[model samples]
Target chain A: MADEAEIFSQLKQAVMEGDEDVAVAAAQAAVAAGVDPQRAIIEGLAAGMAEMGRLYEREECYVPELLVSSEALYAGLGVLRPLVIASGKAEKKGVAVIGVVQGDIHDIGKNLVKMMLEVNGIEVHDLGRDVDMERFITATQETQADLLCLSALMTTTMIAIKDYMPAFKTQLPGVKIMVGGAPLNQQLADEWGADGYGENAVEAARVAVRLLETK
Target chain B: MHRDHSVKGKWVKCDQMTSQERWEALVNRRPTDRVPCLQFMLGHTAVVNGRPIAKIYDDGAESLACQRNAMALYGHDGLIMHGWANAGGAEFGGEIEFPYRKYTGAPLMKKNPVQSEEDAWDLRVPDDILSVGTMPIALEFSRLQYEAGLTVTLQVGSPLTWAGSVYGEERLMIWMLKKPELVHHVLRVITDFIRRKADYWIDRFGAERLMAFDLGIETNKLYSPKQFETFGFPYLREIHDHLTERGTAIILSHICGEQNKNLPLWARLSYGKRGMVSVGKEVAISKAREMFPDCVIMGNVDPVTVQEGTPEQVRMLCRACIEEGKDHPGGFALMTGCEVPPQAPPVNVDQMVKACRELGRY
Candidate 1:
């Protein structure tokens, strides 16, 4: 009998490889074999992605690697999300809304944050890219998400976050906002008056989840 | 002299205002009545504007006429002269895909072409400026920009990124770590190639009409800042040095990524102290004012905003840009963070230039 750790590893590998078929089977197999789905996702798939993040931060990988990891994690979630939601066993970490900001189409980073969230057991409502401030505000309200994440690849679009957050707080007071991307930083984040900022997708996920705890 | 807002002004005529006089005023932190212009137009944007990629790559009178027709019809300032945006990497054999632009009918992107270290080795820097497929087309276009008496800058990839396109990003990082000499060797060749190309354009356009060099890629901070001291900074310095020897006046270094951490090490690109540094939007020009307080700072328009936004939004951006960035004599130029998006609405761009004109001088 394969231990939970062993089955989890297989699931992690499947997710990282972007093999949705293998990921589903591996995840389903783990559950049927008496393994905890939450542990499998967090310690198994999420851990693998977390390691990939560490590697990426250290420059062990590049954009393609980051992209592949995101794709893989999502592939695994395509299976795990349903099983956990159906059994009422899905994570109660917190609900979060995330997407890339308007005028920018790059979403690899956005997708990676989603994977990290799902693996950490947070229910996520993704609005996709080219989203304006209104969409962010509306999504936060409709989903009643505890956290909102915005990503921008260009500095010009990144400033739009400054505009969005103020408007968001006007209606949804104290709703924390986090922003990240190639052209943004902690200073710009501060200047823009964001609640938080991250340099990469993994850091974004970690900070977002951390914010959720305080909320 | 106060000039009215008219696109009909002889901007390209002999009696027209001297570029140095106008450009100097904008960069010197002096508020001009008319907005001085600077941009980073990617080949992708031109293609995406509904012009066919084939025509953009076609080095012929008809193709040039087509591209000119597209840009001129849009009332753009004029295309910058240079090599294909992907010329360096594609010629060196990087994996790339062409995203079809809805408006321009041109293929818009190419990426991830190189997959390994051997792939990097296989990259051969061209001996001639027009060595790549669309390179001649690029040259012709650049010549046309000069012919129209517009400011034309030739944008090229940085050594590391040009290498990344050939060796794959993974190998690029590893090579920097493990085979420093080998990678630097390849970088030198590419640098030499770029220098040769820059000289070729200068020979054709005359240094006065020539704008600057665009090395838009992640450098040391994105990797190791020391690598910048070794590879990115020095290699770039080589280009600037070469241009300086020829008495060229402008050099814009564009690196877009999580690269703010490495700004202090880029002393060679210092502004006001010696020369000008056009930091991309990735590095906040506002923050850079404090960081490299003496350096000339240009840039940070969002390509996507210009591409997909309403004209009003673009005008708002233009205003915010001038307001946010610090200025001095020769300290700033209005440009995008990286390459301008090909699909950017023509009218939005018009609004941006209009916004600049409203703020700048004669």
Candidate 2:
């Protein structure tokens, strides 16, 4: 007997609290009540994730909390995505190809970025870690992505960013390239000809959206 | 390849102080001719020695040669004998893959041993796990460094870090929330393994001769202060107490990434008083010195600058680090924030030593 706004608020609370069962229940309730799937996602799940991002930025929550909240968000999405697709309301904001550069197997940062981007309605094609340069180009060309994001944890692995920037510029002329990781700074990103630099997952998502807008 | 040890550049061999004497003076907060400069340059050493990364990591002779060659090249006061940090997990039944190139950095954990929380129960510290995998390489390298009269610090990964490698970071993170008891159980197993290994090393090298019980996890970046207090602090305290009871003089801890928020928690531990904490590039050395007024502080220099920047830039930064901590009541040593990259310019390292000699004098 809950109203539509009540159901949406429940979904949002479930996500913020990282309760997967409650999130799925709320999503189902929204669907059963004839509430719009897009509204359920944007106003409920995505809104909760945006709040989580703010909490992360303020250091109120850390990686564990962010990760669990993301899991809960995905649980809600699992139920709502099909519904949204069926209703023709599941429009991806932008397409992005992401990976950690070659010689680097540290993918946790990249994984976080991917989740953040997906939660923000960007379609992400993850290439995993230790990805070769050619594989990045292939993924970008195949997906016709709007942006390419690369991550590297070590200075040695980060050299790949500088080495391959020109090649990516020529090969995927239309795609914007963004690089990030512990060892990288904005200066290094600019020096490597990267179009953008994201200090963390939240910023990476924002950068992806901005890149698509500019494109 | 033997080079004469003479007064070169600004670095003069102080005949009055042996390497141990220099280090002891610095640790005891006594004045010395110069502050000791320890180089964590194993990756750079392997590349300069022309050894394959895998061979250098797995073969004792190759690792020793690389360490010795690096000391001769950089003229550092001490050598770090860390063949690879992932070797502990490999010895604990995790599958690891090392790239074939000369400077590919650390080996990868191809397959973790613990697939689920239940699998953690199956993991047991083998009776001779230390001698089985690349650990023997580290032991032999340490033995060689000890015999050569060089100060040697054997680097070991902390329990949570070893467990993460064995169970994967994502799964470990999930377990920390969902199955914390399992995470604690796995940590207990890893702690036992580490204690046994440390005991063996202490028995062989003698506690005083072993420079310090150096533990690295880069835990700060991964866990919040609360989570670290729950999962990381207990094991760290256990290891610290175990080693201290065995007459280990100093315990050095390295935590990578921004650790400004976790410094107070680290300072509160009992063994933290007699130890040195190496913070990453994001931490300001001056602030760390101000915060931990009673502890010896060791680093905050950007490793990337040493790897890619000019020698002059490296020298300037090294000098600035020395200037920041020159007058702290707790002692300071000049070192890279993290491990030096394999491709870090030798000239930059030379400049680091030169800067320490010039600006680090008490």
Candidate 3:
């Protein structure tokens, strides 16, 4: 029988290699070994995903690798997350509402940012793709989210973000707004009154954490 | 020397050659008095013409008229064509929604044709290729281009991109690593469809009059060079070779994003009698010039700047691009790195042409 440290290492390795079966088995082993589910997740599954994110930033890997590794991360989370919740030990740092702005169906970037936020311990409410401004405002208000992240891929759809910003600021006070995508830049985000902008998911997560800490 | 003329109360250099003559000279590798501005424009054309953006994609006659009108309005010299980047979804039996709404730019794939492994295996080229989605409109647009004495255009695929439209991009990408054979199977079908579509266009319009193009998004931001070599390069090479063999006059490939790493593999593909490659701002014009010395380098201007930037800023960038790209061994055309944004200020769009007139002269 593997020790908890060895089991955690196995979980990490499984996710990095994108092997769902190994990830699940290692996670189950952690549960059986009486390791704290939160530690197993943070030290094992999230650790692997963090490394993958770093690799992605360095261009050592690409979207395909990230997609598969995310599958493994989710597979491990499936086993451990429920346990953490049942134990009431899951410590999420902040609440976030994330979505692709209306008329944009390209959600891979949005999805990635959501995953990164989740791994970093944010309770993320994903509104999915082609999300209209009203829905985003409603979700942010309902969740009382600390962060609001919007993504748009096309130049046309990006207009929705700019159009919605004044409303977001007027309606949702104290909520830090972050925007990212292929067509958006820091200058646009700043001009639109967003608190933060990320070029990619890893940076989005980092900025989200910093925003939450500041809050 | 090109003569300077007063137009709209400003001293702008006047073209010694007419647009038609200048375009012909550029294509035949003849010297021109100044740089030509070829627009990679689509949705914006409709905006300028006071029509719904969807008209640019859905109605062929309206699309051509809108484009030609925008060309005249902006004084851009070339690239009068049809089709968008995410093109194959409609032709592959997927449901697509044209951009009728305010924020929609191009057609959106409402559903992907391949939802499962079974669908991937079963995917095939349609028996009636010309009757597929967008084909009739595309043919109509080409017929108009022919009648107007313009270069007839056809949309060929960098098969992997078409496969992404057929299968969802995320699914196709995941399958590349996990189910490579499945990705290859889909690519094979798409490649076959593209070849068949090319043959039909050649048979109808005559290859000499046609400019076949593929909008490739195999950027390093999304794909590694190895992945492009495996999935993007082979199909592109196969298609380019076939088109060249069939005497297609020019092939314009919009290497759509940060594809600096993919340039070597791109360079390996054949371009008919001429090749025109358009790169996004992520790639430097000098690098594009280095990679494809014999092909016309079309761009590196940032589209966001054109839409949101001040006119002088736009002109500054255009002047810089012209200085870098104008002396290429093949040829150079000042253009936006991608589609000029649908809502780009007209003044900003004009700045490109204005820059060519002011500083792009030989």
TM-score of each: 0.60, 0.93, 0.98
- Indicate which candidate wins on lDDT: 3
Q: Per TM-score, what order, best first?
A: 3, 2, 1
| Top candidate when judged by DockQ against the true structure | 3
**Best model per TM-score:** 3
Off by over 4 Å in 3: B1-10
Query: What order do you get sorting by lDDT, best first?
Result: 3, 2, 1
Q: Note the residue pairs that clash in candidate 3.
A: none
What is candidate 3's lDDT per residue for B165-284, written digit by digit as tens? 899899988899999999999898899999999998899889999999999998888899999999989999999999999999999999998999999989888999999999999999
Better of 1 and 2 by DockQ: 2
Candidate 2 CAPRI-style tier: medium
Please report, in order, the local distance difference test score of every candidate based on alpha carbons.
0.63, 0.78, 0.91
- Candidate 3, CAPRI quality class derived from DockQ: high
